[model samples]
Target: MDVKYQVFISSTYNDLKEERQEVIKVVLQMGHIPVSMEFFSAADEDQWSLIKGLLDECDYYVVIIGGIYGSIEEKSGKSYTQLEYEYAVEKGIPVIGILNRDVNRLSAEKRERKKVNQEKLAGFSELVKRKMCQFWSTPSDLASNVATSLHKLMNKNPRLGWTRVLPKEHPIEEIVQTVNVDIPKPKNVVSNGILTERDIRKVLKKGLFDFGSFIDIYFIIEGLYSHSNTETKLPNSQLEWIRKNEIPAHLQQVKEIWTRSYRCIYTFINIRDLAQKRGVPQDVISIGNIFISYIYYVLTEVWGDVPYFNNKPELEMAPKGSSNVKEIRTLSLANLQSVLHDSTLSTQHVDLAVGVAVRWELQAKNYSKAKEYIDKLINRDRYKLAPVHEIFSTDVESIGYFDTDQEGSQFHNPVFRVLCKKGRFVHYLRYTEVLLMATEIYFHLSDHQKALYYINLVRIRNNQPQLKETGNNFIATLLDDWKANLGMEGSYFSALKRNGYAEKVLGIPAFKSVLPIPAQEIALNPNMQQNEGY
Candidate 1:
């Protein structure tokens, strides 16, 4: 079989962009794929997880060092390039290191100014020298050495690589191209041909739904056990098993799925203006805006500060910047808030904005603002609490094979239905959730009467007795209702965290409130800081 090896190029990005591109070209010219951090935003755990997955899959690893030592991760106190090299070594992957012969001889702009980074770079260079290494002084020379070194590495210890029985032919220019030139094509044009209105609509629809499909139900299922004293809580052993295996497996999957989903959204955004001009429905184009705002909200909520791409869709192709969580939240809020009074928006869109606004304001502890948004939803009279039986189900479609049974029968395992299954609508916002949100907001505002009134609506709908308590009694009643009604819907944990019950209920440390930025991410970006206690 004809095979092509995957070569992962590790280096500091800004200083070595051109040189990395040159090396990438040589790899491509030799008929192989080149993987690098240049195509990723490596500042979060998800990104780091994805990087490790790529490194695990690639056939060989290559490290190119320049004057700069690159970013250092706080946890390990080592640069990301060094971390990548070490990981490759630990994994027993073949490594080819290219070190600059003399940093002192390089231009001042290209040299490290900080005394600390200089020492670290010297040490790192020595470490690389201990392995199969080469010396390069310039980009062209580096590319030549990479081509020669990779050839030797492949011949010495060949591995199973990607192969196709019948590979599609490419044009001569595309095959021989050394650098990416953004030759501007028609706004509606794509790799194949003109992006027709049908194509635009189809992609937008997929982009809108694909994002919803990416929401893992495990997050919701895990939330049900987040609080203490739940009968359904997984045993410590099962929880450990999930943390060690399932979560990481899904995280890798989520990274891959979300990466493709973002590209789909980006494609729609890039051709949106043209699609609109081409007479695609306004509703179709509107999906792009709605998808982006909601995605930003979801991403920031999970990843703290993610790489912002909506404002600059081009960065999706070549990411080089970071976004603050708060700023992205503010933008998403503004985008949603702006469309509240939009005459053209559908009721579903309007309600989505209001419900999300309520959650956002609640997250910020602006209870009064949250109440205002919730009132817009409740006062409209279009929504009402549904019976618990109507809203939830006990149907078992497929059993999740979590074999806690020592004898191999998974009869006692918890069966979690796939949330991303076709035609299954994952509820992002629900009327009952909004009702409980109103209850909390009203309680915070010291309006016990309104709080009791809203909570009673859901309680009465579910054939449960109304809550007649005030003060802490009312707080307890409201929280119980939130868990009972919104259990496994992904909102209970947020409610616990929001109501200051996480520590008391979950018994986790305050530092565990936020997730840690992946060590590789911090190592890649010197300015990036890890979360507290990480």
Candidate 2:
């Protein structure tokens, strides 16, 4: 399988543009994705969220601590370079630091001008040395060190990433074509209404999906849950979706309100039963939980009520009389626990399974269990609590993508492009949320000290001082941190949707927290009804 990793590059952009380009080249050559601030704007609050998210998704973090102190965030008075390092270490990501050998011999333009920034830069470089790091005087030398360092750390860390689904396949090709596209709105989405694909057949899309089909389930799941949409619905357009103090009503596709939705959920009971009967490997059987876990969570995220404990393939109407997400979550936990017991899966795979359960606990406001699962998610040896940058020469695919094909511009997200093209497996979980969940769990539990302990780790990682107060203000900060780190990763959208903030943010009243059943479904089935507002 062709597996690629995303690396975040953090440093001053203008000065080290050449060095950044070289680094990006090496990462691409090695079949990894390089994410840098070049794809973002320092002034945009929305882009900062993406910056955090990219850092969160990356497998390895590399720090190029050159002479320059880099750009600073006004609120914190700390350079992003320093803050990036803080986040990478705080997150427990493997850190590989490369220094610009013999600092004094460097050209004056590349070095820091302000005395305070120079001092800060010196301290940051020293901090990188506290771990396994290297020194390089030139961009080429830096590339060599970076390649070797990342190579070693990958063998050591081995994150849950995509592999080739087919045997002896060529690397996934990046087709950069200039083509105009009008992103289509999802059809059949009514205001504040849930749109579920009628049955597992809707999920299979007129294809066969028996439990005994072990060899091809992963491909089927990946095809169904692609991050890219058939309709080209934008994912995390930082400019429009995540702005502060401003609701972006225009960017939203008027699908649910003016149109309708066509989506689906499958029964976990059948998948489990079939896998067991087929005598599939525990790993394969367990992966089914990931698919089902996602389906359960997405339904809960939109509707807060869904059918649970159903052995039947079709769930036409939601169960009546108190079938909240809590019950659905309990069933999910039981199913995932059996999957977690097997030793064949990777830690990332196991953590991925548990993280969804924690998300459910948070959604249900079950703080204690969220805290417990979070403890299991964070590993001192396996995860990191900081940010690292794999810098790029330009923002080509990372950001600043307003250019349309009419003007002959092409855009691509390296990660998504690769995963959809040649990658194997369906990985829906983001492990960084474990720490963020801990902070929220502790905050809700009124364990201020513990809450600050977790929140401060991320705060201090961003080169900001700890919060002086550990009250609602601290919790507010924690939520912002959560939104920033989680961004558009489905978690944030779901969180906002679950809490009825989507109506507020999207500037639509009928945009209810729960989606309404389609009018057609109501006609076909007498038991079906609509959401309250819709």
Candidate 3:
């Protein structure tokens, strides 16, 4: 019932006949109606006129170019195909050209005919070069190329440029009023000495509190809360009772402590100094100490932590004690790591510290050590940490303590399963990953046999079935597969860096491979200097 398809085909009779036939067959295969003069015999003037009308009405025009020039009729002195192509161009219709190479490679007389044909086709080539017309070298390439181009063109969003245009009588004042607005200011204000509820809410909302403000507010609140005697001191409660009641409360407290700790550490240190000057409660000072210790552990593991505290003797004079109420200030990664690794550290405390370290190491791009610590923490049974995927999965039954679908459904979320739990620690590094890294190093060192052995070892674990033999090409393929599969697990970037491929693969400038002195650190200490590049 519907007149669905249409295309106009134009080509020289002598040279492009075969090519044009191929194109017509393809057009039919693509489910379009084709109109061409070649399909009809001579002496059909009525059919010829119908074909010309179809050519003008059809959706697309196809031009086939071959070696031989089309014949010049004795009286008209112009080829019908040439005239059709010119008309199509003049009408601003989309045209596809197929050039037949077999016809191009012909005898001298045929070549002369081709030269004449080209002269007729010269304007079309210019249009094709300018991207106004699409051209294909062969008939086979035509269908695929045209289909792909049309698909892409149809999928592209049409840009709106003239939607605002209207009759000259339209009111401009209404449009101007719709686009303008005035900024508003908050009504409540507080004095600088003490933070009011509104001031606290504002600071929290803006996320503008520095480390000093964090320490001040946290310590001040913690001091008042600790003295308030809100916690029910349960001396003889059973394990089950504690788990059902006291433990939940304890966990809430721990969460608050860690949240405050994180904010204090990340915001900068002048707040802690301010807290000390203001004579904040001892437990409040301990919170800042513990936060600093956690940060130091992460920095040390990743960047070969510098001993800034030891270098500054005045800072090392803080009290040293095991009580949570006292401020024990030791500034060194080694000290921080030692405290975290200590067996006597409470499970809750160690879990919080390890979680912070893992997060920091990952953020600092010290993934290797992060993996190592995560693996250690996960393997410990007392910690009750789960497997990475199990912890991160979106299946409601399997969602770990840290998993949240706030951003979207589980399927669309980007956070890894293992890292989902807020305080749940998991072992990240496996022996297989270490072996893979070693294999990559061996490959770089040109120890082909050793490299193949290690690569095949990992492949076997992955159930790949086959063992690769020693060779450059095999190693390259193994590396390619490794990068593809092991990527996002945090290996690809490190491998790129280790193998001198960071610049090539990541587009990282060569100077960025090494750590630079942070601008703030340099500003604080005149002795500090930046890395080679800013």
Candidate 4:
């Protein structure tokens, strides 16, 4: 049987220091624990008790009788080293005693300085010699000799030694404590609103561009290979900041994003409040509620958590566990459309509202709810797949502007036509995309029949043939549709993350599914912690 013996190394402190170290090295290499004077305290009563305790626990004793008689314990009238050796003898510990081969040949400084000390040294050497004494001229030789002797002693004595997994007096929890990381959430359920001129203009403005561009650049790096081949090498520090998914300090002229977003949300609420106080139109309150909801959606996507309750912006962050993006998106749409019924909300705005709702529901993984929003636009039959020419078309209409058939601008689609004047249909959503999303949802739901039906609906719209069902065909079709329609406008990367494909697509680890909080933000806010990987 194997055992790990604790072998006590006894020696004069000054002369045998090197030899003790060498013995410890050899003992450790042989899988035994070495105890020695190096770890002991003074020659007092308490230390004597400690030494006796150590001797009692040890499996064997080592007496290295060098040239010098070390300091004496006054009570015992013997060098402490000799006292320890004798105590081990009384305790019946297996002893391996080593002697200097040429003690007389050593220099005067290496030998005992006083006559009494010299006599004590000679007596101690004689006592150790009474056992099976070993002789060595050097530390190395003594280490090797004592190792062989200790092994024999251990086999002869046959006592149990130290081991792992021994029973303890207390549980493991007594010694160690664990701390958990804080995760953030989204908050504030304002009676949410639909798309409006004020909301659109605010989204389009410069103050919000930093926040929007933060998203664009982030997805650009994370989705680089999805569209471009430009290799990006950034310093770890800058990369860490980018990983926070916030605007980098160097990219901004001012850190006004938080204030701007806050002000925008607050201003809407204030306007709505003042209007109510003045007995203004009910549509005014609807506008405030819907914008508040939109702001909540934006903040949730950007910061992972934000607070807005009962149409109010709470300054603090929301708890991550409490967030339910699906419920928020679902409830907000109802309030938005209800407000619309009381006002003349345009078809384009209504489509945008539902498109946003579809997006949020998908993000929340509420497939059925997302499909509800998708079907609304699909039932309307107003949006369709952009023709091949329309998709590949230039941003500007052809020089012959009179040609109604000419290629058009990149912003005319029902979902994405907000910025386009008259050029063509550039959509954030189209009938084909809605069909693809339905296909994706059903595939996730394991309804292969419906998945196939919806996928073919998209295929026919794109003037392409229906896909043949096979392993991973749904994913292939979804990617194909993304390539043909939503080509590289920041949605592909998000979709990849949602489907657990970002690691395969972007070569990033799964723990980095979200960007780290900005390093500066973390530095400034002690309450915030970086996301796991970053």
Largest TM-score belongs to which candidate? 1
Segments of candidate 3 deviating more than 4 angstroms: 1-333, 346-391, 394-402, 405-492, 507-509, 514-528
- What number of backbone clashes does candidate 4 have, counting pairs of residues 3 or more apart or in separate chains? 15
Task: Give the Cα lDDT of each candidate.
Answer: 0.63, 0.54, 0.42, 0.56
Ranked candidates, highest TM-score first: 1, 4, 2, 3
lDDT of 4 by residue, 1-534 (tens): 245677788887777789889997887778776666573444666556556766777788888887888877887799888888889999888888899999888777788778888888888888988876799988889989988898888777877774432112221122111101111111111114232334323322222222233333333333332432222443222222233333222122112333344555655554455445546556566656655565556545544543334443332333222244555555666766675465554565565566666667777888887777777766764555555556424322111111213322212233122112223322233455566677777777787888888777767766888776836556865875665555434456556656767577556566555543433233333344545554
Those runs of model 1 whose alpha carbons end farther than 4 Å from true positions after fitting are 1-199, 217-281, 312-321, 392-425, 518-529
Q: Kindly give the stretch of ten consecutive residues in candidate 4 with the minimal lDDT sum.
A: 177-186
Candidate 3, residues 88-183, lDDT tens digits: the string is 667765666555445455555544445555675564344444533355556567656555543343235221111111112112222122221221
Evaluate model 3: give its TM-score: 0.29
Could you tell me every candidate's TM-score relative to the true structure? 0.57, 0.43, 0.29, 0.45
- Model 4: how far is 281 from its true place, Å? 4.1
- Give the C-alpha miss distance for residue 288 in model 3, angstroms: 9.3
Model 3: clashing residue pairs? 67-114, 212-271, 374-427, 375-427, 375-428, 378-427, 392-417, 402-420, 402-421
Candidate 3 at 422: error in angstroms? 16
lDDT of 2 by residue, 1-534 (tens): 446576777767777888888887787667665666663445445556556666676677887878888777888887777777888889888788888888788899878888998898888888889987988889899889888988988888888643322112111111001112222122322223332222211222111122112112222222222211232432454323322222211112211211111112232344344445546456655766755665576656555564443443233334233256778788877878876797976666677677777777787788887777778866535556434231122221111111222322122334233322222211234434566667777777888787777777767666778876685466446656655554433455454543445555445455344444432232222343444654
2 or 4, greater by TM-score: 4
